[model samples]
Target: MAVLKKQLEDMRGIRYDIASLKGSISNLKTPTARQFVSPRQMMTNGKTPTKRSTPNPIGVGPSCISRKKPVRGNDPRKSAARTKARRRILQGKQISEDMMAALQMEDLKQLCSMHNVRYRGMPQARVALRKIPGLIVSDTEDLPNRSATGEEVQGANMEDAQSVESESEEEDDDSSEEAEYFEGPEASKDVQPSAH
Candidate 1:
């Protein structure tokens, strides 16, 4: 019975020593410190964020927005002239042969319809041409010198005719002076006519 008691005491001492050793080992252990990062290290390690570049919108800057004036289309004067021509044709006034040649087929049709004129064959074309005033024949091979009736006539060149008319006026003045001088002397000579 005394040996059994001694064995129990030895077992108890062994267990107590084991428990103390475990507690000392736990106290020696320390928590590892957290790692700190520097700016240079962060950039090198691809951890830093970067900003992205963007494109500007159109018509924003002075170079793009402050431009010169925009381009223009056809002249208004030309359109007004065309409109006036159309109105005259619609009023049943005869269009000149020259003007008729200048107009397109569509214009002719419009003019005829507006004036309520019946457009017949080619023969009526001549009749229509004679009715319009202010129309001069254009100098084109297709349009020969002809009256409204399509009769071939020797039409004088407008420029040449004007020059000739001015010259004729000067000649008429010279002839009138000559006539007065010859008539004054010839009146006395006729009264004494007997030296035959």
Candidate 2:
């Protein structure tokens, strides 16, 4: 009789489970609960699915100024002291003696003009320019020097044209001299004592 009662309790539990499942199915069918239901799986147009188009969210689009963007705070000149002139400036050193001594009369004049220093001649200009603080030498000290004024440039151009013409004449005279030096192994052997 106890086994029959236990069997009856199991049968009741099965029925209760079926009733709960039916309730869930009914809830799923309701319009309010079915709000999240996906649209019908039927394809649009010619029954093909299409991916939605989206703008690239990464880098700048077509409006970017240059393809190579300047990364923030990455100046190579600043990072590496590539030049002695740059290193000197960074160290806050005064005018280098070599640069100061190498300074031409024109350079001193230019410096004196910058500081509004009045000087009679090259010596006075050099002295006055040396006295001024924060005088800077150009990084391109090795570059071909140019005068500050237009008049000087005009005179220089005339001189250059004349020199070019003169050099052509000099080249003609030197051609015979150059030929002796270009006699291959014979010329080099002449410089030696003939290896007695």
- Note each model's CA RMSD in angstroms: 30.6, 30.8
Mind giving the per-residue lDDT tens digits that candidate 2 earns over 1-196? 9999999999999999999999999878545554453454647553545578778788757665666878886655533432443344345444443455555566566556656899998778767766765554334332223455533232125556669978987776677556655767657544422211
lDDT (0-100) at residue 59 of candidate 2? 78
Each prediction's whole-model lDDT (CA): 0.58, 0.58
Which stretches of model 1 miss by more than 4 angstroms?
Answer: 1-54, 57-108, 117-137, 140-161, 183-196
How far out, in Å, is residue 180 in model 2? Answer: 87
Show the colliding residue pairs in model 1: 94-131, 94-132, 95-132
Compared to the true structure, candidate 2 yields what TM-score? 0.22
Q: Which stretch of 10 consecutive residues in model 2 shows the poorest summed lDDT?
A: 136-145
**Runs with alpha carbons beyond 4 Å of true place in candidate 2:** 1-94, 136-196
Please, what is the TM-score per model? 0.30, 0.22
